[model samples]
Target: MRIEKEYRIFEDIEEVRIFNATKKDFYKPTPKEFDVEDMPFQELLNNVSTEIHSFIPYENGKDFIIQRLGTFTLNKYNSKPKDAMGRRLSKISPLFFDILHEYFLEVYESHTPKKIRFVYYNGKKLTKLSTAKIVFDMDRIFVVTNNVDTATNRRVDADYRTFDEDKTNMMENFSQTGSYYKVHGKYVWSQGVYNIINRAKEDSDDFYNIVFDLVIPEDQHIVDKIFYLTNNETSQCGEVIRIRTANGVMKVIEVNIYSYFDDSGIIIRQGLINDITQRSDYGLSKPVDFLMDGFKNSKKLALLIEPLSKKQYEFSKGFYYMIEKDYGDYNHSRKIMKNIVEKDVVKNLNKLINGELDKIDEVLTFKVDGNSNNKKIVELYIERFNYNNEVHSLGFLTDVTEDIEKQDKLVASNEQKVVLIKEIHHRVKNNLQVLNSFLNLEKRAYKNDPDLIIEHMQTRLTSLALLHEKTYGTKDFVNINLKDYLVDHDMKTEGFMELPSQVEFETIVDEDLNLSIEVITPLLLIIDELTMNAIKHAFPDNTATDNKITKQITKLNEGDARLIIKDNGVGIPDSKSISKNLGCEIIKSLTSQLGGKISLIECEKGTAYELIFPIRMDHTIN
Candidate 1:
């Protein structure tokens, strides 16, 4: 019995067409007579013992068509008899078609069976996730699909249970009252302690900046705390201070700071702040005695030199450890400084020593002769101070290699963003020039036909607009998905023609094809002009029952690309007619702009053009 059916093809474009044919006509190779051993699994296994949820026999031909689907397969997909009986596999599962297509090609070539596990979302919002497995038969190209969603969910639930138990145990050991915070340079992660103290949460507030503002103005010791922490002189400190909350309420809090060297040699500071406002004896009058003994064990290198004599010097234990030496192994500070510090820094140090400069503060890059011989960037500060009736210089050297590297990377990223902006500007300027040229041509050629001029100009501008729209919708600003751009242009062209239901439009583009903006802009204009011309001139009577147009793009071998635009309308009568057509001239010009050659393809029903272009790999415009 013959039945009429409509189906759609391609993932990006919904190309619909209606055709009437017998049920057997849908399968290309014609389904073999149903036999027990001819089933999908019977050919794979000697004995059929397992259960099958969805068994689909697909004909491997130019188009992957489903010969027939088992009752279970129909129920699993929630499809009707007519839909599953004689339809393309892509219509059943558009998202999974590419995967199935790849497997079909492999099995067709090598005659080797394949198996794949995939997840399918059924609903429109894609809220339900169902896992399915496809197993290919070597002898027969049918697929055995089994829904394994239940089994997969069991394993996922077990993982969640174990994670919940671990999280519960961790929460039981964590302190709920004290707030914990960690700071590494400008990055800060906290447990909302500062927000509670401020009495209001602010998205833009920085942890360290907020803490500094919270400390009462009279508490000048916070400056000293920051200095010691910044120089990595102390490992831990505790202080009781008064802070005014956002509500103008004064409260007492005890803050404990701990500093440690991370694996990358960057110092990280962790803090815990406890509110002690209700306590009667909060130790408000007591002084904060910083941990001065931590200097010996600290990672920072310190130096004390008698500037006048230039002979007496004392180096911290960190300096000796850094140089791979024991205490008193290197006595002369000048000798050690000359080897590690840059010559310019040493010259500045001499200036400080000779009273030419009051102090010297700078970041200098140098390499130390140590076990690893790694380059070190250090922030150096030296100032002369009176001690024991003698002129001495107390200087601290903090390793800032990691911080400086991070800053350099940030600067490089900003510069790259600027270059991208400039490229975008250049693309815009070029598009404007092209549009202006079209305007001038339209003025000279079709001055009397204002409506025709506006129509052509409108479609050209729409083509450019759609190109930018697709390019901006994606994360990649340099190139856009070629298939997506073609589908969008097809839709806009139809909008211009206002023939939504009259023409059967289709786009069969390679899903992986992407082209740079420089190529796409001109390429899209050419497609638009050709497609619109066919729609206008191809179907003069607009009564043909099989009016169809198709746009296909595929990657060719040797780094070339092919674009084909064809229709089933009346073919072009004469080849010379194209030479005198203005639209044809525009198409030729645009094809040349892309460094591509255009030629007419011989088709039985209607006109077809093939454009071969060298794909740009560098994604840059000349």
Candidate 2:
């Protein structure tokens, strides 16, 4: 028989008092069995055990004061009393200190008992495996630490190595936004599966119950498949399914399952779940096929972009068609962006690409190279989303060239209507002024005869009304054809006035001359005044019977035009008397208003007045 030596593990317990009275508060050891100044407490603590240590957390949480140090801590850290006592824990192990700071805070604030297990290493070799228990009472803290058994230590080290390898494999093969789980027997979940599916460790234990409860009714077939795989020990299976979250949001996920047997001959199933809610598709399923069909049939170009990289990941066929390219390559989308005409649109697109903007809804214009070299207008809408823990942008570009052109035409039409309204208003205001001027003249000329003044007013108003009626009837409100206006004026005057039966009126006008309302208004008034004067005075009751009046308008040149009014009646009795007649004076004033000069012609049998005025180049039809 072999003789076996027994090993006893020692526990080190320490009590510390927190002193708040000092300027710099600190914790000090309160040894109940020994005097403060005698017996060398450090040596006593060191000789007790080689596997335990006790400490009091400082106010900062990251640093601690050593209340007692066992041989294990001393040997593993190679620490001395003076150097290690009341020192920052970061000075020894900054990474470990950071890891334990939260636990230190939790124990201190809760004032409750807590236990923590950790491994300590000396260089590359594992030196100690221990567990720490902390308690607080009566303004004091008691800490106890014990060394773990050799078997437990070895098992923990092996588990840590296996965990690291599994973690590496998972990261290499699966999405980071996914979670891994292991199930044993009927719906029994592993301890490592926490906060997945049901979001609570206790609730996640019954995997089948959680799956059935969370899965959408339409995706019940997926749950059935999972159940069958778990029961039949299937090698592997993957499926995309939808579930409703606790908050009433629908989520899409991809589940990959692998089945095996544990050492105890119990069936074990491993599952990898990836939340693919933001992805457009998983595989060539009905949903993906329908989505691709939608993209193909849509007139808008759909695309996906990586926000951080500003790179196009996927695009629909319409994108290539819009660019006039047979296929899409890496540089093709960039080429399309280069054709954007608006710099602000480019900046907004960059903002969407860089995750600076959440959404962009705007119309952008592009100068496209094509047969006609026409500009294409497109409505661009982009929205930001997350996929696999990274920001992405989904966007659509709709060709709105025809729609935009129609909108522009409508706007132009409205603007033209506004201009026409303003021109009409201006013409009405001018006609009113002319009527007011006529009223003043008639009041002065025929003040003694109210009826005669009213008659003159009516005649002048009639002429103005005729001009307006002609203008309002036609589409062209600003300019009037001189020939048409003169003919209409003659017909309208016949309805209002009665002349000698022997007298006849004839008009000869240039067919291509179109005059604006400004010129036509004053010119028609002058013609009315001159014709009335000719009918009333030149062809009097006792005068010659065979009388004729001729009104001729001719374009002399590009810059000037002539108007001649001749009547075959008695000439002015005396040339000096011409200034005395109000009609003659009015004609002179109106001729001046037209920026023209007037001269009386030496006719053989009639009194003739000739007027010449400047004509605008645009007034001519040709």
Candidate 3:
């Protein structure tokens, strides 16, 4: 007969494809070759001993076996010999038989699949199988993966996290520094002493300066003596020493060591060191008044770099507060450097740690999430210091978003105030100069006539005061509103100024036009002098027989504005006389100050005075 085998896998267990594959030579091919029901119980027991796996057996079930293949057998590899009680040895033990019986019962009762390497057929050979081996029609079962922290090494408890913020981390970071020699320590053959000590030195040799003022004795003999005394009980097992961090804070450490012969037959010592700086027995916990002295009140997260490991940093709580994060070390490293964006910053940070840079006090602006375009500025401050003999960089990062914004606003406000103050000063100076000129003119020409002098001074003072008012009254002091100023006052000079109501005064102002106080103040005063000159001298006798008079006003060009005051009474004298008059001299001086030019034109009606000046169109009114 041909043989075929298959493993049909399933949940819980696998199935055997062949229910009863027989190697027996039966009396009839389709009839029972083994007559279990017909055979006597004793004969079945005898058959079990003869061919152990020919019949199915169960625990405490010798009565229920196929009658002819009665007695139970055991798996030879796991079977135990009978003891001194005179019991005989069996191929299968009672306990395993019980297990087998229960397993078979479960299969028979529930039709569940079970993989069993049972002796197959009368040939009594074991065959591999799975729960799915049987050709049974059943619905497919769904399988799901379970997520949990599982350790394949069941008895091992170590997954060292050097940043657990507890004693476990402290122990791992400052673990015993040397290994037990296999021959000397009996069972500790895991790590060699030399390898352990060398790695310890590589990790910490640079940090051992003066070490708490209890420096390790340099003399070889003294060190040996101390070790021997410690082992012999003449000295304590540990020596207390201080170790300073690069940040300059000193911490206490306890060192213990044992000497032994290694596999190389060389004498070696293994050491265990403990940092006891914060322990209560060390008295560093502090008095009541100092208990909470240096604790931070700010919400910023703090992390310490000393005695930290890459794995610990990957799982750090401080990193959790950042907007971006990944679950592994490679991702952490990629983004930590990648997010910086500025290559120079990374270069300088390396230099800072290497003691090549003076300091790292800079604002690092980057996206909150590594890949985002939104940026934030953080003040990264790092300082280098030496502890023991090792160099370390201590860094502090602070978000300066609010602070920078407030600083910018304050600077803008102060700048505006300064401009306002300067404008006020300019206005004061202009009015004072106008007052000086008015007083000079009155004292020189109208001194003999008190009434005339007072009258002229009052009118001049009013104009000067009105100009000051216009400059101060509006919030914008840099530029004077020309349109408003034109109509602001009535030009009310009581004795010296009177124009016919029929003599219409008209003005044109560009919507976008204004003049700086520096230019406008002098120009306005000059306009006052010229207007009085035209009214007083140009129309001397009101002699025009016509019923109406008119004055022409105009603008000269795009940047230049013109003021023309013309009348119909009379014409001006010769240029020589006008230039020689004190009023003309004042007008000329004021024009010069205003960066303007004044012209007197002879017209058919009378005289026309023209004042042309530059105007600042930037500061405009609608």
Candidate 4:
């Protein structure tokens, strides 16, 4: 079976009626009766309802219209005056007189009015009361404007009743500034005294019972008190507040309670926090004694340096600058000194200080200015500066100056001696050469003499000439190359010694050997005489002629040398035989001066003369 569903619409049909307690009947009272004093509240309400019901035009025998008019009628005694429609529903024409009536009724009954007549324009306009409504039950209560629903919502109708922009905005601001609400659910014109009292009672009760819930007013009061202190500028505003912490040290807090009012009347609150904590404790009363001591020491140092001349003082200042706290000032002073000081002096001082150059140890010989004595005294005082350590360089300067002067004089003397020695050697060599030339010339003049006699003279002349030549050419005239002397003398034999020259001469010599010229002269002559004798007599027969004569000049050591002359000539005829010859005796005497000895040998090679001696090549007579 199919079921059909029916929908029923239910509306609120609460019946509202008014009863007159004084008249004991429901009667339509004229608008004039609304002014009657001493009427009960219910009497006034019933008169207004009855008048509204009877006056309302009915259509088609319908009581709904009358009922609607009666329900909507505002009680004139308790409602503020309204417009034409509102006045007509009140049962009286003069609505202001109803205010008088309500006031008198309160006096006569010895009671406060339970309901109040308030002129609240239900419509939104500020001046015009377009619709008026009465508050049925209310007390003294706050009324605040609030945001209304827009026309799109079902609450508003086609008549376009809305709040004015300025009034609406004012209400919105007032509502936000403080808490408020109407006591009764009624517009301002219909509000009663009871509604206000009831509203006040409700708020007071809430505050008494649940005071913890009201945080806004209390917080605002605290904020106001803090701002009052900050705005007075009695102290440094926005300074962090510090207190002794649990750790027993002062710590700054971040709480900000200060506010500054700007020129445009805007208040800006700022945070009071800082990285550095301000000191609040006073431990010591007087300044530290140690700090005073330091100040006194600094002043003493400054005074001690002040006695010096500006330049000297600055020098001392530079020393102090190294240890000063502000190094920039010290560096600035140093730069000034560097720019003004002489460059050469600085360079010399730098060299001495850095140990790159040695300091002078004796006075320098600079000519003194404006001195009557004309003394050549040394000036040796040192200019002092510090490098690695403190040293007394004054002594070094004095000693070195004196030493340098002595060295210079000695060098000059040595140079003069060298010149004199060279000149002596040159002169002696020339004289000996002249003597050799003279001997040659003399020998030529005596052509009639025996060959042996002339040969002997020439050899002796050659020996003298060789000595002078060696000394003249030598690096040190005091020393001669012994090998050169021997070679020179042996070469001369071709001119002097006659042939079938049975003496075939040879020399073995030290290539790098040198000897004193004094020794060389005597040694050369000794070899010459011995070699001549060997050639003339050692080879008495042609048997010795086939052999050679050997002469050796050698350095036995650094300090000694030997000259050995030997030949295949016949052996010395006899030691006494050669000893009788003047040449042999002269050779022996010269050998003795050389601190040497000569030996004559009778070997198969013939006769040999070996001379061993000390060569004092570096000896100086000066």
Candidate 5:
């Protein structure tokens, strides 16, 4: 048999790094391939060790250091190790350690020994306690610090854990501050710290508190510096703060801090910063508050300059609220600002703000020159009020000087377009009228049987002409207010007979919904045809006329409308002439084109024809 040769990607020696050798292969090892599942567990352990080592940088291991010292390991589970115990050198599985162990591993080197310790407490003693092994993952260590309180009282004795009104209110305020000092020892963190401190106190452990003092740590003190430098102590971490000065203006300060670094290294801390003054009773005195207040009180507009009275200016800087409104309406913002300003003022300052009022809605730059920061802030809002237990929207104005200028240019262009549109409608209407005149001339030329021929032709021409009239009268050239125009036409027509003067013919339509000009034409012709037929046939002789009639035009929704013509008269007789009337035939045909349903009912009092049609009013603006 020929000698077999096995091919491998790496040299035999290199392949050995990945594959393990069997007992007999130590001298002349047989080739073996490595698979994902077959990879040595020791390799996985080494890789984890390398990752942990790389993550914990030299300068940012403060939190991790404190954590690892505090945590318990399988090798060192008892009290502090005075000497290096042989057990300390034993191997530890990553699973045996807690989340803090992995967290520490992510930040620190695997081979590095953990240093520092932290004991958590919920009371004067470390009772009912558990400990974590601070590994490279222990950057989230529970360290001992008293400068800022982080206690939650949820763990207090069950019987005494009932809801507390004052504490609840304080909790809310504390929440606003982002982090608050839990004055009482009822909080869990406080209990933890108290327990840890007492334990240390019992054992004379003064090393922890002595390391950190009342003063902020140098590395984690950026916030303290910004607040102290700006002297804006009103800022609280993790919350929105409003600062209002003596005047009625306001300033809003939002502070957020997500990281802290101490002697050992960097740590993560997340919280909001808010100014309590913004929420206090005197917020109206802030500067922004005053301006917003003035804007709201003014009829047309309002204008405000920066650097108002210190108190008012502070209020202005601190004021903050959300403005909401319906689609296409700007009034929501104005209303929100107005409500905030007016609610806090005793006297209206309209007189002083009168001249400036007209420009309130106008866009302008609000510049504060005293501070190094100088920029214009733009705002827009609308007027609103709550009436009859409901909120009603009023018009809104905006500081859109640039936007307004552009809009003005656009409007100018649109105006030119409007003129052209009007001209087109006018020309179309005139042409339709001229055609009507031509029909009249034709009638004169064809004098024989003129009544029958002219009537049919006139109805057709009028149907076309009605569209022009509707187009010219409507603000939107595409949609027509057919009901109003038709009712007007009925009033204007000279030959139409009238019912009791008090009886009214009305149209109930949704003003917001628009309808196409095409639909209106067929609808009008159908109405005219029915009305004329009814007038002529319903009361054949005027001497026998003792009936009332009224028409109702109602739109069901955006896509459909109904027309009802009811009268008190003799019902239709069972004759083909009644159904075969030319007008009736034309009505049915036209109704088909409109995608509508027609019903003719002979009620005991009279006859009623209800016409329903589908319509789409394209009113969405680009």
Candidate 6:
């Protein structure tokens, strides 16, 4: 069995009438006068049978047409709107035309025909409003005023119909600000809006001859979709979009729209488009991007640097303008750092980038060409980011004049304190030498004593004084190099032997080793006692031609130190009895002071002594 369908939608004095000829379905003979004002468009479209096509809202003064209503019409005939009518058989209504207007205009707001999901109920359970759907013609929704003549770059006028004043004044104004629809996405009635847009486009003839053509090709569908959103009844705000200018230049702008629907079903739209190219969040007013024009007024010069490239980068004249005084990578280093203070800052900066320094809050102050009054102090802050496989640093330079003045004053005070400290060290070293001289004078009185105790006392005082002599030789008064001390002490003690020219001395020190004066002093005195003992007993047969002394100091991988001394000499006749000697007791005390052990072993050709101790690195600051 085949089916035929037809619909009649007519309006009378009191209510609208809708009838389906095929099924003989009617919503009402007199759709009982319900106030259209109270009727939400959804409920009214719901009340009518889904077979009414061509919703013609006819009034005495105005003509309105609603097409593409197949879901409501249940029409089997799906054809295009008639190009030239042959005759009126329920007036040439088709599925596409009737349902397009039904779902988009009547069922919802003025939008391009799209498949919208709507819940409905004939009598019992809720279901989709229409199984039939209409494809969206996103192109046709925007007509006439949107037309752009490729040659002239001009907008064509959209035809309009005039109505009564007081009631339609808002509609007339809306038509001027925003192009609007009259017959729900079918026709536009914009007079003022098209005129203003055309005029604005004409005024900026050089760059954008067609201002009304500012609508971006891709954005047309979005604009249509936005106006049709369910709850967006009254207003829509701040829809930013990209638009083409007269010369096809892209610009960013913000648009706002307001919807006005009168009781007579007259729809109006009002909108505002503002160019935000120079907004703070955009290019012109930004910290980096604003440098084109804004930096000419700024007292400081901000640089855009690429450390990896280390070269000049051209600025876009229209977008970015480099200040003539600003330094690029090629010249910035030499230009910024002329004085010692600033040069030191550059050195430290390299250290920071090389991972040698960890401090970030660096400040440097310098005077330009000896002008003390023109001192400028800058507190630098840096941030790092990775770009193009290279780590880059962005730095902000801010003047800190007041803070630097305070720092300079404090630095001068610190310099005075440093001078005072250095003088004290000088005095301490000199006082120690003077005390050694006083002891030498006192030892003169005990010269006649047996075993020459006064002689040993004099040698010990001389060794202690040598420590101060070494301290005064270096800039750092606290820490001393063990290797340098060993070399110097060996040279000084060579002349103590009766035949010093015949004896050969050799010293071997580890690659990197340093010790404090406190540790070296006890060891120096121990070496002195051993050297004196070697001179008295080592070559007892008066054989200086075969005499040789060797000293070795090494730092082990396990953080311990070893000292070895060997001399070609007659071994101790009574090594046990030597423990009773005052010199032996002193050596043991000195070894204990260093927290080490001393061993005496007679080798094949000489006597050998080995000292082992922990290499404590706790003492750093003087």
Tens-digit lDDT string for candidate 1 (220-301): 5874565455344456677877777776766676777666555565445555565566553654321111222345675656
Clashes of each: 0, 1, 12, 39, 84, 15
Tell me the TM-score of model 4: 0.33
- TM-score, one value per model: 0.44, 0.51, 0.40, 0.33, 0.31, 0.35
lDDT of 5 by residue, 591-612 (tens): 8856799888657766788888
Off by over 4 Å in 1: 1-289, 293-343, 346-359, 366-376, 389-392, 398-425, 443-449, 470-477, 557-559, 617-622
Residues 545-605 of candidate 3: C-alpha lDDT, one tens digit per residue = 4422333334566678876766665566577787887788888888887777788776776
Judging by lDDT against the true structure, name the best candidate.
2
Q: Please list the C-alpha lDDT of all candidates, in the order they appear.
A: 0.58, 0.60, 0.45, 0.40, 0.39, 0.48
Sorting all predicted structures by TM-score, with the top scorer first, yields 2, 1, 3, 6, 4, 5
Question: Candidate 4, residue 171: CA error in Å?
Answer: 91
- Stretches of candidate 6 off by over 4 Å are 1-466, 469-473, 477-479, 495-501, 617-622
The RMSD of every model to the true structure, in order and in angstroms, is 46.2, 17.9, 23.5, 34.3, 27.5, 23.3
Taking all chains together, the TM-score of candidate 2 against the true structure is: 0.51
Error of 3 at 65 (Å): 57
**Which has the greatest TM-score?**
2
Please provide, for model 2 over 271-379, each residue's C-alpha lDDT reduced to its tens digit, 9 standing for 90 to 100: 6565565563533211122333467755556543332343434456676666566653435344556778888988987787666888888888877653337677888
Output the better candidate (3/4) by TM-score: 3
Ranking by lDDT: 2, 1, 6, 3, 4, 5
The 10-residue segment of model 6 with minimum total lDDT is 8-17
Weakest ten-residue segment in model 1 by summed lDDT: 7-16
